[model samples]
Target: MVFDDKNADQAQSLREKMSGVRNGLKVITLASGKGGVGKSSITVNLAIALAQLGIRVLVMDADFGLANIDVMLGVQTKHNLTHFLRGERRLDEIVHIGYDGVRFISGGSGMMELLRMNEGQLSKVMHGLTKLDMPIDYILCDAGAGINDNLISMILASSETIIVTTTEPTAILDAYALIKTIVKRDNLHPLHVIMNRAESKKEADHVLDGFSEVLAKHLQKEVNRLGHITLDPEVPRSIKRQTPIMISAPNTSFARDIRSIARELLELPPQKEPGNVFSRLFSGLRK
Candidate 1:
Protein backbone atom coordinates (compact mmCIF):
# COMPACT_ATOMS: atom_id res chain seq x y z
CA MET A 1 0.00 0.00 0.00
CA VAL A 2 2.49 2.55 -1.13
CA PHE A 3 1.34 6.07 -1.95
CA ASP A 4 2.93 6.95 -5.28
CA ASP A 5 4.36 10.35 -6.11
CA LYS A 6 1.05 11.57 -7.47
CA ASN A 7 -0.80 10.69 -4.28
CA ALA A 8 1.90 12.30 -2.19
CA ASP A 9 1.71 15.44 -4.26
CA GLN A 10 -2.05 15.64 -3.88
CA ALA A 11 -1.78 15.20 -0.10
CA GLN A 12 0.75 17.98 0.04
CA SER A 13 -1.56 20.20 -1.99
CA LEU A 14 -4.36 19.53 0.46
CA ARG A 15 -2.07 20.49 3.33
CA GLU A 16 -1.26 23.70 1.51
CA LYS A 17 -4.94 24.47 1.16
CA MET A 18 -5.25 24.25 4.94
CA SER A 19 -2.09 26.29 5.50
CA GLY A 20 -3.76 29.58 4.60
CA VAL A 21 -6.69 28.93 6.86
CA ARG A 22 -6.63 29.85 10.52
CA ASN A 23 -6.03 27.04 13.04
CA GLY A 24 -4.86 24.70 10.27
CA LEU A 25 -8.24 22.99 10.57
CA LYS A 26 -10.09 21.40 7.68
CA VAL A 27 -13.44 20.76 9.37
CA ILE A 28 -15.59 17.92 7.97
CA THR A 29 -18.98 17.53 9.56
CA LEU A 30 -20.72 14.15 9.29
CA ALA A 31 -24.51 14.25 9.44
CA SER A 32 -27.41 11.93 8.68
CA GLY A 33 -31.07 12.38 7.86
CA LYS A 34 -31.86 9.60 10.28
CA GLY A 35 -30.09 7.16 12.56
CA GLY A 36 -29.18 3.44 12.09
CA VAL A 37 -27.25 4.31 8.94
CA GLY A 38 -23.70 3.80 10.34
CA LYS A 39 -22.91 7.52 10.46
CA SER A 40 -20.78 7.33 13.59
CA SER A 41 -19.10 4.16 12.37
CA ILE A 42 -18.05 5.88 9.17
CA THR A 43 -16.84 8.96 11.02
CA VAL A 44 -14.70 6.98 13.45
CA ASN A 45 -13.03 4.78 10.82
CA LEU A 46 -12.58 7.63 8.35
CA ALA A 47 -10.72 9.60 10.95
CA ILE A 48 -8.67 6.51 11.76
CA ALA A 49 -7.85 5.86 8.12
CA LEU A 50 -6.71 9.43 7.60
CA ALA A 51 -4.59 9.25 10.69
CA GLN A 52 -3.10 5.99 9.49
CA LEU A 53 -2.01 7.87 6.37
CA GLY A 54 0.01 10.18 8.68
CA ILE A 55 -2.59 12.95 8.84
CA ARG A 56 -3.28 14.58 12.18
CA VAL A 57 -6.97 14.01 12.77
CA LEU A 58 -9.41 14.88 15.53
CA VAL A 59 -12.90 13.49 15.95
CA MET A 60 -15.14 15.99 17.72
CA ASP A 61 -18.05 13.96 19.04
CA ALA A 62 -20.60 16.65 18.29
CA ASP A 63 -23.53 14.26 18.37
CA PHE A 64 -24.38 16.20 21.55
CA GLY A 65 -27.34 14.24 22.85
CA LEU A 66 -26.25 10.76 21.76
CA ALA A 67 -22.47 10.94 21.39
CA ASN A 68 -20.84 7.50 21.25
CA ILE A 69 -17.43 7.78 19.59
CA ASP A 70 -15.86 7.13 22.95
CA VAL A 71 -17.69 3.85 23.43
CA MET A 72 -16.95 2.81 19.87
CA LEU A 73 -13.27 3.51 20.37
CA GLY A 74 -13.16 1.93 23.85
CA VAL A 75 -12.31 5.24 25.48
CA GLN A 76 -13.15 5.50 29.18
CA THR A 77 -11.94 9.00 29.87
CA LYS A 78 -13.36 11.03 32.68
CA HIS A 79 -13.60 14.37 30.87
CA ASN A 80 -15.59 15.15 27.74
CA LEU A 81 -16.42 18.01 25.38
CA THR A 82 -18.85 19.43 27.91
CA HIS A 83 -16.10 19.71 30.48
CA PHE A 84 -14.05 21.75 28.04
CA LEU A 85 -17.09 23.75 26.98
CA ARG A 86 -17.83 24.62 30.59
CA GLY A 87 -14.26 25.87 31.05
CA GLU A 88 -13.43 23.07 33.44
CA ARG A 89 -10.44 21.99 31.29
CA ARG A 90 -8.63 22.70 28.08
CA LEU A 91 -9.48 20.94 24.80
CA ASP A 92 -6.22 19.02 24.64
CA GLU A 93 -6.63 17.92 28.22
CA ILE A 94 -9.93 16.25 27.37
CA VAL A 95 -8.94 14.68 24.05
CA HIS A 96 -8.38 10.90 24.24
CA ILE A 97 -5.74 9.55 21.89
CA GLY A 98 -6.88 6.26 20.38
CA TYR A 99 -4.85 3.18 19.47
CA ASP A 100 -4.50 4.35 15.87
CA GLY A 101 -3.01 7.67 17.00
CA VAL A 102 -6.26 9.55 16.32
CA ARG A 103 -7.41 12.07 18.93
CA PHE A 104 -11.08 12.37 19.89
CA ILE A 105 -13.23 14.45 22.23
CA SER A 106 -16.23 12.73 23.74
CA GLY A 107 -19.71 14.30 23.68
CA GLY A 108 -20.63 13.07 27.16
CA SER A 109 -24.41 12.66 27.41
CA GLY A 110 -24.43 16.36 28.25
CA MET A 111 -27.94 16.93 27.07
CA MET A 112 -28.81 19.72 29.53
CA GLU A 113 -25.34 21.23 29.40
CA LEU A 114 -25.35 21.57 25.63
CA LEU A 115 -28.94 22.78 25.55
CA ARG A 116 -28.26 25.40 28.21
CA MET A 117 -25.19 27.03 26.71
CA ASN A 118 -25.89 30.76 26.65
CA GLU A 119 -24.47 32.95 23.92
CA GLY A 120 -21.59 33.99 26.13
CA GLN A 121 -20.70 30.43 27.03
CA LEU A 122 -20.94 29.33 23.42
CA SER A 123 -18.65 32.18 22.41
CA LYS A 124 -16.15 31.20 25.09
CA VAL A 125 -16.21 27.56 24.00
CA MET A 126 -15.65 28.48 20.38
CA HIS A 127 -12.82 30.76 21.36
CA GLY A 128 -11.24 28.01 23.41
CA LEU A 129 -11.53 25.58 20.53
CA THR A 130 -9.71 28.03 18.27
CA LYS A 131 -6.89 28.24 20.75
CA LEU A 132 -6.03 24.52 20.50
CA ASP A 133 -2.33 24.47 19.59
CA MET A 134 -2.16 21.15 17.77
CA PRO A 135 -1.49 21.39 14.04
CA ILE A 136 -4.79 19.67 13.36
CA ASP A 137 -5.11 18.62 9.72
CA TYR A 138 -8.76 17.75 10.04
CA ILE A 139 -11.55 18.13 12.60
CA LEU A 140 -14.28 15.58 11.92
CA CYS A 141 -17.51 16.60 13.60
CA ASP A 142 -19.90 13.64 14.02
CA ALA A 143 -23.22 15.41 14.27
CA GLY A 144 -26.49 13.75 15.19
CA ALA A 145 -29.36 13.21 12.77
CA GLY A 146 -32.24 15.57 11.93
CA ILE A 147 -32.62 19.29 11.24
CA ASN A 148 -31.72 21.31 14.31
CA ASP A 149 -30.08 24.62 15.03
CA ASN A 150 -26.87 23.03 16.29
CA LEU A 151 -26.65 20.66 13.33
CA ILE A 152 -27.24 23.54 10.91
CA SER A 153 -24.53 25.62 12.56
CA MET A 154 -22.11 22.66 12.38
CA ILE A 155 -22.81 22.22 8.66
CA LEU A 156 -22.41 25.92 7.95
CA ALA A 157 -19.13 26.27 9.83
CA SER A 158 -17.59 23.11 8.39
CA SER A 159 -15.37 23.14 5.32
CA GLU A 160 -17.31 20.10 4.01
CA THR A 161 -20.36 18.05 4.95
CA ILE A 162 -20.70 14.26 4.42
CA ILE A 163 -24.30 13.11 4.55
CA VAL A 164 -24.63 9.38 5.34
CA THR A 165 -27.57 7.29 4.18
CA THR A 166 -28.53 3.82 2.97
CA THR A 167 -30.37 2.33 -0.05
CA GLU A 168 -33.67 2.06 1.78
CA PRO A 169 -36.42 4.24 0.35
CA THR A 170 -37.09 5.89 3.69
CA ALA A 171 -33.40 6.65 4.20
CA ILE A 172 -33.00 8.06 0.70
CA LEU A 173 -36.07 10.28 1.02
CA ASP A 174 -34.97 11.57 4.42
CA ALA A 175 -31.46 12.24 3.11
CA TYR A 176 -32.86 14.26 0.23
CA ALA A 177 -34.98 16.16 2.69
CA LEU A 178 -31.93 16.99 4.78
CA ILE A 179 -29.99 18.16 1.72
CA LYS A 180 -32.94 20.33 0.67
CA THR A 181 -33.07 21.89 4.12
CA ILE A 182 -29.35 22.66 4.07
CA VAL A 183 -29.59 24.29 0.65
CA LYS A 184 -32.59 26.33 1.69
CA ARG A 185 -31.15 27.40 5.03
CA ASP A 186 -27.38 27.59 4.64
CA ASN A 187 -26.80 27.45 0.88
CA LEU A 188 -23.10 28.22 1.12
CA HIS A 189 -21.05 25.08 1.66
CA PRO A 190 -20.49 21.98 -0.49
CA LEU A 191 -22.14 18.68 0.48
CA HIS A 192 -21.17 15.06 -0.25
CA VAL A 193 -23.04 11.80 0.27
CA ILE A 194 -21.92 8.37 1.51
CA MET A 195 -24.19 5.40 0.94
CA ASN A 196 -23.71 3.11 3.92
CA ARG A 197 -24.84 -0.46 4.62
CA ALA A 198 -25.39 -0.91 0.94
CA GLU A 199 -26.25 -4.51 0.03
CA SER A 200 -24.67 -4.36 -3.40
CA LYS A 201 -22.86 -2.02 -5.75
CA LYS A 202 -26.02 -1.66 -7.80
CA GLU A 203 -28.02 -0.67 -4.72
CA ALA A 204 -25.41 1.93 -3.82
CA ASP A 205 -25.52 3.32 -7.34
CA HIS A 206 -29.29 3.46 -7.15
CA VAL A 207 -29.11 5.40 -3.89
CA LEU A 208 -26.68 7.90 -5.32
CA ASP A 209 -28.74 8.24 -8.48
CA GLY A 210 -31.91 8.91 -6.54
CA PHE A 211 -30.20 11.51 -4.37
CA SER A 212 -28.68 13.28 -7.37
CA GLU A 213 -31.97 13.21 -9.28
CA VAL A 214 -33.92 14.76 -6.44
CA LEU A 215 -31.34 17.41 -5.63
CA ALA A 216 -30.94 18.43 -9.26
CA LYS A 217 -34.61 18.40 -10.16
CA HIS A 218 -35.91 20.17 -7.07
CA LEU A 219 -33.11 21.89 -5.17
CA GLN A 220 -30.99 22.69 -8.24
CA LYS A 221 -27.90 21.72 -6.30
CA GLU A 222 -25.19 19.43 -7.58
CA VAL A 223 -24.28 17.00 -4.80
CA ASN A 224 -21.13 14.91 -5.01
CA ARG A 225 -21.02 11.21 -4.22
CA LEU A 226 -18.16 10.55 -1.79
CA GLY A 227 -18.55 6.77 -2.34
CA HIS A 228 -20.19 4.03 -0.31
CA ILE A 229 -19.36 1.45 2.42
CA THR A 230 -20.80 -2.01 2.01
CA LEU A 231 -22.58 -3.88 4.75
CA ASP A 232 -20.11 -6.27 6.49
CA PRO A 233 -20.29 -8.30 9.64
CA GLU A 234 -16.87 -7.04 10.66
CA VAL A 235 -18.48 -3.69 11.38
CA PRO A 236 -20.67 -5.11 14.13
CA ARG A 237 -17.87 -7.34 15.33
CA SER A 238 -15.57 -4.38 15.68
CA ILE A 239 -18.33 -2.50 17.42
CA LYS A 240 -18.66 -5.26 20.01
CA ARG A 241 -14.88 -5.31 20.44
CA GLN A 242 -14.86 -1.53 20.91
CA THR A 243 -12.39 -1.07 18.10
CA PRO A 244 -12.50 0.33 14.58
CA ILE A 245 -13.05 -2.13 11.76
CA MET A 246 -10.17 -0.65 9.84
CA ILE A 247 -7.92 -1.86 12.62
CA SER A 248 -9.72 -5.01 13.68
CA ALA A 249 -10.53 -6.37 10.24
CA PRO A 250 -8.47 -4.42 7.78
CA ASN A 251 -8.84 -7.06 5.04
CA THR A 252 -12.62 -7.36 5.24
CA SER A 253 -14.84 -6.18 2.38
CA PHE A 254 -16.11 -3.11 4.23
CA ALA A 255 -12.63 -2.25 5.44
CA ARG A 256 -11.33 -2.42 1.89
CA ASP A 257 -14.20 -0.18 0.79
CA ILE A 258 -13.36 2.34 3.48
CA ARG A 259 -9.70 2.31 2.49
CA SER A 260 -10.68 2.96 -1.10
CA ILE A 261 -12.88 5.81 0.03
CA ALA A 262 -10.00 7.23 2.05
CA ARG A 263 -7.65 6.99 -0.90
CA GLU A 264 -10.21 8.67 -3.16
CA LEU A 265 -10.64 11.39 -0.58
CA LEU A 266 -6.89 11.90 -0.48
CA GLU A 267 -6.74 12.18 -4.24
CA LEU A 268 -9.40 14.84 -4.46
CA PRO A 269 -8.27 18.04 -6.12
CA PRO A 270 -7.98 21.06 -3.91
CA GLN A 271 -10.94 23.42 -4.03
CA LYS A 272 -10.26 25.79 -6.92
CA GLU A 273 -11.09 29.47 -6.90
CA PRO A 274 -14.22 29.92 -9.01
CA GLY A 275 -13.08 32.88 -11.10
CA ASN A 276 -10.66 34.08 -13.73
CA VAL A 277 -7.30 35.70 -12.97
CA PHE A 278 -8.70 39.23 -12.85
CA SER A 279 -11.48 38.22 -10.47
CA ARG A 280 -9.07 36.34 -8.22
CA LEU A 281 -6.73 39.32 -8.22
CA PHE A 282 -9.55 41.63 -7.23
CA SER A 283 -10.76 39.29 -4.56
CA GLY A 284 -7.24 38.94 -3.16
CA LEU A 285 -6.76 42.69 -3.19
CA ARG A 286 -10.10 43.14 -1.42
CA LYS A 287 -9.05 40.66 1.24
Candidate 2:
Protein backbone atom coordinates (compact mmCIF):
# COMPACT_ATOMS: atom_id res chain seq x y z
CA MET A 1 0.00 0.00 0.00
CA VAL A 2 1.22 3.47 -0.90
CA PHE A 3 1.63 5.95 1.96
CA ASP A 4 1.73 9.71 1.95
CA ASP A 5 4.95 11.02 3.50
CA LYS A 6 3.24 14.20 4.69
CA ASN A 7 0.51 12.21 6.41
CA ALA A 8 3.14 10.01 7.99
CA ASP A 9 5.08 13.00 9.28
CA GLN A 10 1.90 14.54 10.61
CA ALA A 11 1.00 11.34 12.40
CA GLN A 12 4.46 11.09 13.95
CA SER A 13 4.35 14.65 15.18
CA LEU A 14 0.87 14.13 16.66
CA ARG A 15 2.07 10.95 18.41
CA GLU A 16 5.05 12.79 19.87
CA LYS A 17 2.84 15.61 21.15
CA MET A 18 0.41 13.12 22.73
CA SER A 19 3.25 11.27 24.47
CA GLY A 20 4.62 14.48 25.91
CA VAL A 21 1.44 15.49 27.72
CA ARG A 22 1.45 14.32 31.35
CA ASN A 23 -2.25 14.75 32.04
CA GLY A 24 -4.55 11.74 31.79
CA LEU A 25 -7.37 13.33 29.79
CA LYS A 26 -9.43 10.58 28.20
CA VAL A 27 -10.11 11.46 24.55
CA ILE A 28 -13.28 9.82 23.24
CA THR A 29 -14.27 10.12 19.58
CA LEU A 30 -17.95 9.46 18.90
CA ALA A 31 -18.55 8.30 15.34
CA SER A 32 -21.30 6.64 13.27
CA GLY A 33 -21.72 4.86 9.94
CA LYS A 34 -24.39 7.22 8.59
CA GLY A 35 -25.88 10.60 9.29
CA GLY A 36 -29.11 11.17 11.28
CA VAL A 37 -28.05 8.52 13.79
CA GLY A 38 -28.15 10.93 16.76
CA LYS A 39 -24.36 10.84 17.26
CA SER A 40 -24.07 14.50 18.24
CA SER A 41 -26.95 14.43 20.72
CA ILE A 42 -25.42 11.39 22.41
CA THR A 43 -22.08 13.19 22.51
CA VAL A 44 -23.61 16.35 24.00
CA ASN A 45 -25.61 14.58 26.68
CA LEU A 46 -22.84 12.13 27.53
CA ALA A 47 -20.39 14.96 28.05
CA ILE A 48 -22.86 16.75 30.28
CA ALA A 49 -23.56 13.58 32.23
CA LEU A 50 -19.87 12.90 32.70
CA ALA A 51 -19.41 16.48 33.86
CA GLN A 52 -22.20 16.03 36.40
CA LEU A 53 -20.08 13.26 37.90
CA GLY A 54 -17.46 15.98 38.59
CA ILE A 55 -15.34 14.98 35.61
CA ARG A 56 -14.09 17.93 33.57
CA VAL A 57 -15.20 17.34 29.99
CA LEU A 58 -14.75 19.22 26.70
CA VAL A 59 -16.58 18.52 23.44
CA MET A 60 -15.00 19.22 20.07
CA ASP A 61 -17.65 19.54 17.34
CA ALA A 62 -15.48 17.98 14.67
CA ASP A 63 -18.40 17.16 12.37
CA PHE A 64 -17.12 19.88 9.99
CA GLY A 65 -19.77 19.90 7.25
CA LEU A 66 -22.73 19.80 9.64
CA ALA A 67 -21.52 20.96 13.05
CA ASN A 68 -24.25 21.78 15.57
CA ILE A 69 -23.18 21.04 19.17
CA ASP A 70 -23.06 24.76 19.93
CA VAL A 71 -26.58 25.22 18.59
CA MET A 72 -27.84 22.25 20.57
CA LEU A 73 -26.47 23.66 23.82
CA GLY A 74 -27.95 27.13 23.07
CA VAL A 75 -24.48 28.69 23.38
CA GLN A 76 -23.64 31.05 20.58
CA THR A 77 -20.05 30.92 19.38
CA LYS A 78 -18.17 34.12 18.68
CA HIS A 79 -15.23 32.19 17.32
CA ASN A 80 -14.67 28.59 16.30
CA LEU A 81 -12.02 26.01 15.41
CA THR A 82 -11.31 27.92 12.21
CA HIS A 83 -9.87 30.81 14.17
CA PHE A 84 -7.62 28.48 16.11
CA LEU A 85 -6.55 26.60 12.97
CA ARG A 86 -5.66 29.89 11.32
CA GLY A 87 -3.56 30.89 14.37
CA GLU A 88 -5.84 33.88 15.00
CA ARG A 89 -7.09 32.53 18.35
CA ARG A 90 -6.01 30.11 21.04
CA LEU A 91 -7.94 26.96 21.89
CA ASP A 92 -9.07 28.38 25.21
CA GLU A 93 -10.35 31.43 23.44
CA ILE A 94 -12.46 29.37 21.06
CA VAL A 95 -13.76 26.90 23.65
CA HIS A 96 -17.32 27.85 24.65
CA ILE A 97 -18.62 26.80 28.05
CA GLY A 98 -22.14 25.43 27.90
CA TYR A 99 -24.90 24.03 30.14
CA ASP A 100 -24.01 21.53 32.90
CA GLY A 101 -20.32 22.54 32.89
CA VAL A 102 -19.54 20.95 29.56
CA ARG A 103 -17.28 22.98 27.23
CA PHE A 104 -17.31 22.79 23.41
CA ILE A 105 -15.38 24.02 20.38
CA SER A 106 -17.33 24.60 17.21
CA GLY A 107 -16.11 23.19 13.90
CA GLY A 108 -17.63 25.96 11.77
CA SER A 109 -16.73 25.96 8.07
CA GLY A 110 -13.14 24.99 8.66
CA MET A 111 -13.79 21.27 9.07
CA MET A 112 -12.83 20.33 5.52
CA GLU A 113 -9.54 22.13 5.88
CA LEU A 114 -8.94 20.21 9.07
CA LEU A 115 -9.44 16.93 7.25
CA ARG A 116 -7.16 17.87 4.36
CA MET A 117 -4.34 19.37 6.40
CA ASN A 118 -0.78 18.53 5.41
CA GLU A 119 1.96 17.60 7.83
CA GLY A 120 3.03 21.10 8.93
CA GLN A 121 -0.50 22.38 9.31
CA LEU A 122 -1.59 19.23 11.10
CA SER A 123 1.43 19.41 13.44
CA LYS A 124 0.60 22.97 14.37
CA VAL A 125 -2.95 21.96 15.17
CA MET A 126 -1.78 19.07 17.32
CA HIS A 127 0.62 21.35 19.16
CA GLY A 128 -2.18 23.78 19.92
CA LEU A 129 -4.37 20.95 21.25
CA THR A 130 -1.61 19.81 23.62
CA LYS A 131 -1.15 23.39 24.87
CA LEU A 132 -4.74 23.53 26.18
CA ASP A 133 -4.46 24.15 29.95
CA MET A 134 -7.86 23.00 31.17
CA PRO A 135 -7.79 20.37 33.92
CA ILE A 136 -9.86 18.13 31.68
CA ASP A 137 -10.76 14.53 32.47
CA TYR A 138 -12.29 13.91 29.06
CA ILE A 139 -12.30 15.38 25.54
CA LEU A 140 -15.23 14.12 23.44
CA CYS A 141 -14.69 14.53 19.71
CA ASP A 142 -17.97 14.68 17.70
CA ALA A 143 -16.54 13.41 14.48
CA GLY A 144 -18.29 13.41 11.09
CA ALA A 145 -20.29 10.37 10.14
CA GLY A 146 -19.07 7.49 7.98
CA ILE A 147 -15.59 6.39 6.89
CA ASN A 148 -13.42 9.17 5.59
CA ASP A 149 -9.71 9.78 5.83
CA ASN A 150 -10.32 12.49 8.43
CA LEU A 151 -12.78 10.39 10.45
CA ILE A 152 -10.46 7.38 10.47
CA SER A 153 -7.47 9.52 11.43
CA MET A 154 -9.29 11.10 14.38
CA ILE A 155 -10.65 7.66 15.47
CA LEU A 156 -7.12 6.28 15.49
CA ALA A 157 -5.85 9.33 17.36
CA SER A 158 -8.42 9.09 20.13
CA SER A 159 -8.04 6.76 23.14
CA GLU A 160 -11.49 5.25 22.53
CA THR A 161 -14.04 5.17 19.71
CA ILE A 162 -17.78 5.04 20.50
CA ILE A 163 -19.79 3.71 17.56
CA VAL A 164 -23.42 4.89 17.60
CA THR A 165 -26.18 3.29 15.54
CA THR A 166 -29.91 2.75 15.42
CA THR A 167 -31.79 -0.52 14.75
CA GLU A 168 -32.22 0.37 11.10
CA PRO A 169 -30.75 -2.24 8.78
CA THR A 170 -28.84 0.32 6.73
CA ALA A 171 -27.44 1.92 9.83
CA ILE A 172 -26.30 -1.44 11.14
CA LEU A 173 -24.59 -2.26 7.84
CA ASP A 174 -22.82 1.07 7.87
CA ALA A 175 -21.74 0.57 11.44
CA TYR A 176 -20.31 -2.79 10.50
CA ALA A 177 -18.47 -1.27 7.57
CA LEU A 178 -17.03 1.39 9.81
CA ILE A 179 -15.86 -1.19 12.34
CA LYS A 180 -14.43 -3.44 9.67
CA THR A 181 -12.42 -0.57 8.23
CA ILE A 182 -11.04 0.37 11.62
CA VAL A 183 -10.12 -3.15 12.69
CA LYS A 184 -8.45 -3.83 9.37
CA ARG A 185 -6.35 -0.73 9.96
CA ASP A 186 -5.73 -1.08 13.73
CA ASN A 187 -7.68 -2.71 16.54
CA LEU A 188 -5.70 -1.72 19.61
CA HIS A 189 -8.10 1.03 20.73
CA PRO A 190 -11.30 -0.08 22.45
CA LEU A 191 -14.63 0.17 20.58
CA HIS A 192 -17.96 0.80 22.32
CA VAL A 193 -21.42 0.48 20.73
CA ILE A 194 -24.57 2.40 21.65
CA MET A 195 -28.05 1.80 20.29
CA ASN A 196 -30.01 5.02 20.00
CA ARG A 197 -33.77 5.36 19.49
CA ALA A 198 -34.30 1.78 20.47
CA GLU A 199 -37.97 0.82 20.90
CA SER A 200 -37.33 -1.62 23.72
CA LYS A 201 -34.46 -3.12 25.69
CA LYS A 202 -35.05 -6.54 24.22
CA GLU A 203 -35.03 -5.12 20.70
CA ALA A 204 -31.80 -3.27 21.35
CA ASP A 205 -30.21 -6.43 22.73
CA HIS A 206 -31.34 -8.48 19.77
CA VAL A 207 -29.97 -5.95 17.30
CA LEU A 208 -26.60 -5.65 19.02
CA ASP A 209 -26.40 -9.42 19.42
CA GLY A 210 -26.73 -9.95 15.70
CA PHE A 211 -24.31 -7.08 15.04
CA SER A 212 -21.76 -8.46 17.49
CA GLU A 213 -22.06 -11.95 16.07
CA VAL A 214 -21.22 -10.70 12.59
CA LEU A 215 -18.09 -8.93 13.83
CA ALA A 216 -16.87 -11.88 15.88
CA LYS A 217 -17.56 -14.35 13.11
CA HIS A 218 -16.23 -12.34 10.17
CA LEU A 219 -13.99 -9.50 11.33
CA GLN A 220 -12.71 -11.21 14.50
CA LYS A 221 -13.28 -7.96 16.42
CA GLU A 222 -15.13 -7.60 19.70
CA VAL A 223 -17.08 -4.49 20.76
CA ASN A 224 -18.60 -3.64 24.12
CA ARG A 225 -22.31 -2.76 24.16
CA LEU A 226 -22.35 0.43 26.17
CA GLY A 227 -26.19 0.56 26.35
CA HIS A 228 -29.23 1.92 24.54
CA ILE A 229 -31.55 4.95 24.53
CA THR A 230 -35.31 4.49 24.25
CA LEU A 231 -37.40 6.71 22.00
CA ASP A 232 -38.87 9.42 24.23
CA PRO A 233 -41.06 12.40 23.41
CA GLU A 234 -39.14 14.56 25.83
CA VAL A 235 -36.00 14.07 23.74
CA PRO A 236 -37.37 16.08 20.84
CA ARG A 237 -38.83 18.66 23.18
CA SER A 238 -35.47 19.09 24.87
CA ILE A 239 -33.75 19.34 21.53
CA LYS A 240 -36.22 21.94 20.32
CA ARG A 241 -35.58 23.94 23.48
CA GLN A 242 -31.86 23.77 22.85
CA THR A 243 -31.35 21.83 26.07
CA PRO A 244 -30.08 18.37 26.81
CA ILE A 245 -32.61 15.83 28.06
CA MET A 246 -30.30 15.11 30.98
CA ILE A 247 -30.83 18.72 32.05
CA SER A 248 -34.34 19.37 30.77
CA ALA A 249 -36.01 16.05 31.56
CA PRO A 250 -33.64 14.34 33.91
CA ASN A 251 -36.22 11.73 34.91
CA THR A 252 -36.96 10.65 31.35
CA SER A 253 -35.90 7.30 29.93
CA PHE A 254 -33.58 8.94 27.36
CA ALA A 255 -31.78 10.97 30.01
CA ARG A 256 -31.38 7.99 32.33
CA ASP A 257 -29.91 5.82 29.58
CA ILE A 258 -27.36 8.47 28.69
CA ARG A 259 -26.35 8.82 32.31
CA SER A 260 -25.99 5.07 32.58
CA ILE A 261 -23.72 5.10 29.53
CA ALA A 262 -21.63 7.82 31.14
CA ARG A 263 -21.16 5.69 34.25
CA GLU A 264 -20.20 2.73 32.10
CA LEU A 265 -17.58 4.77 30.28
CA LEU A 266 -16.14 5.98 33.58
CA GLU A 267 -16.04 2.42 34.85
CA LEU A 268 -14.04 1.25 31.86
CA PRO A 269 -10.28 0.95 32.25
CA PRO A 270 -8.76 4.32 31.52
CA GLN A 271 -6.41 4.51 28.57
CA LYS A 272 -4.62 7.65 29.76
CA GLU A 273 -3.09 5.89 32.79
CA PRO A 274 -1.34 3.29 30.62
CA GLY A 275 0.77 5.78 28.64
CA ASN A 276 0.74 9.02 26.69
CA VAL A 277 -2.23 9.18 24.27
CA PHE A 278 0.05 10.07 21.39
CA SER A 279 2.27 7.07 21.89
CA ARG A 280 -0.69 4.72 22.01
CA LEU A 281 -2.31 6.32 18.94
CA PHE A 282 0.94 6.38 16.96
CA SER A 283 1.53 2.74 17.71
CA GLY A 284 -1.90 1.92 16.31
CA LEU A 285 -1.56 4.16 13.27
CA ARG A 286 1.83 2.76 12.30
CA LYS A 287 0.66 -0.83 12.47
Output the number of the lDDT-best candidate. 2
Taking the tens digit of each residue's C-alpha lDDT, what string does model 1 give over 54-165? 7888888887756889899887879987877777888789978886788888888757777655434544544454457776788888888776655655565567788899
Candidate 2 TM-score versus the reference: 0.86
Where does the lowest 10-residue lDDT sum fall in candidate 2?
1-10
Which stretches of model 2 miss by more than 4 angstroms? 1-13, 109-123, 268-287
Q: What local distance difference test score does each model get? A: 0.75, 0.80
Backbone clash pairs for candidate 2 read none
| Model 1 error, position 224 (Å) | 1.4
| TM-score winner | 2
